[model samples]
Target: SQQGEEDPQALSIQEGENATMNCSYKTSINNLQWYRQNSGRGLVHLILIRSNEREKHSGRLRVTLDTSKKSSSLLITASRAADTASYFCATDAYTSGTYKYIFGTGTRLKVLA
Candidate 1:
């Protein structure tokens, strides 16, 4: 079941400026991941921040997880028009020795040229 909510719901940013969005969840998770979906196509995994880790970075993408606050944030630096997409946060939970990914409502990001 999806138990997370992404703030802003929609965002618009100019090229070169960084974009930041947040995801807040309920329940314990083994890991939290950020993904980008272009026009509802398959998702492209952006970053995964484990419960034990506070922050991680890949290329121009940065993710931060605050388990204490049950929230996570994704930051994209130097954005481009291609970066425009819907971003989702999925919580990985383990139960009965099986792992399940619960995705939250996405944040629509429009990167203008």
Candidate 2:
């Protein structure tokens, strides 16, 4: 599979703290996108940075891409309890037509109040 795998299946942090997670994939990709899923909620798009880009930030979240190494990292600063959720990395292999994103197994993050 051309999917990525995230380290540390789960994480716990206090409110107003920071959280970091890493992902590694097997295939080359055009872009990578980060998503958040709160419990039973749908996945919400967080940010997406293309292969040519090294880093991108959205609000309190920051994402770094290293295409040469087939790896990516996500950093959330000053995390709040509300930030508790599962985070996933989805990648599109720069393919045409039928190809879709392959999502990582995800990292479950718990932010303590």
Q: Who wins the lDDT comparison?
A: 1
C-alpha lDDT (0 to 100) for residue 102 of candidate 1: 91
Displacement of residue 7 (Cα, Å) in model 1 is 0.9
Estimate every model's Cα lDDT from 0 to 1. 0.93, 0.91
lDDT of 2 at 37: 97
Q: Pull out the clashing pairs in model 2.
A: none
Give the distance in Å from residue 46's predicted Cα in candidate 1 to where it truly belongs: 1.2
Candidate 2, residues 1-113, lDDT tens digits: the string is 63989877999999989999989998888899999999968999999999999999999999999998999999999999889999999998545666689999999999999
Poorly placed runs, candidate 2 (over 4 Å): 94-96
Check candidate 1 and list the clashing pairs: none
The superposed Cα distance between candidate 2 and the true structure at residue 26, in angstroms, equals 0.6
Off by over 4 Å in 1: none
